[model samples]
Target: MRALFLSEPPFHFGVHEPAPDLPSRIQALVDAGDREEAVVLFQREAVGLPDAMIAQFRATDAFAGVVPLAQSTVYDATLARELSTPTDAMLAVDVPVTILCGQQTFPFLSAAAERLAAAMPHAELIISPESIGHRLDAHAATRILAARLA
Candidate 1:
């Protein structure tokens, strides 16, 4: 995944050397920084936004870009439009990719995961029994992901 969804490169190296107050202090800093960075990048990259849309995007950068290894856009027209790929992009990776989608997300991701696993040959799909979310339980998810990737 490298820095696919990270604003900075350091964290990708497993060097997350957070301070004693890192948990408490980092959120505000990362939130603010990620927001500002995403806005600038999107404004530069995304074009033809309605004025209102632009104004709305001005407030946050949460939509900047997805971390490649992270579960992302629901598989749908928007995702297809964003990716413009009828095929699974994960197939191209040298490393195998495992998609663990939230059960609550639009059904397309689960459907797409199956289709992708079929098409990609090297990938795996695991739909969580429970709905997944932004701050999902990392420990449990990690175990699932690790087993699949292994």
Candidate 2:
């Protein structure tokens, strides 16, 4: 079976430094029922997308559809903690695993992809140079996946 994994945090990756206060700050907004502000704060601080891009996205119908789900951002803090957990059992599977990362993504994520590729016997890593931030070029990715499956 063929599988495509995108922007997956490495199992062995660890950030020992204290996390920024953004999570708590966002959580506070969520707790206070200001979910929209929490989402905006996360997009501004954590996602770090350009203001113009964010504005354009916010104008889209898709953004409006998902706005109500912003309250779930509170749970992201818990999910972030679990990202560093070991994944030896999953990596041990013999099926080929393709890990795709954007070349312009954060350094730590690239490092994690490299480390994951090293650990998995049947895994390969691809850094898409044309990708932006954490978003991949889906057309290119589909071609790569097709070749692998062939």
- What TM-score against the true fold does each predicted structure earn? 0.39, 0.67
lDDT of 2 by residue, 7-113 (tens): 54534356442255767888888888887677777666554545786787788896776567776655554455555544678768678888888878755567778
Residue 17's lDDT within candidate 1 is 21
Clashing pairs in 1: none
Residue 132 in candidate 1, Cα distance off native in Å = 3.8
What's the TM for model 1?
0.39
Q: lDDT for every model?
A: 0.39, 0.68
Question: lDDT by residue for model 1 over 1-150, one digit each (tens)?
Answer: 521110001111112122233222323433555534333333222222345655664555544433221122112212334443333344465465565655544333445555555655555566665544322356657677566545
Q: Cα deviation in Å at residue 6, candidate 1? A: 15
Per-residue lDDT, model 2, residue 85, is 47
Backbone clash total for model 1 is: 0
- Where does candidate 2 stray beyond 4 Å? 1-4, 8-12, 16-25, 40-69
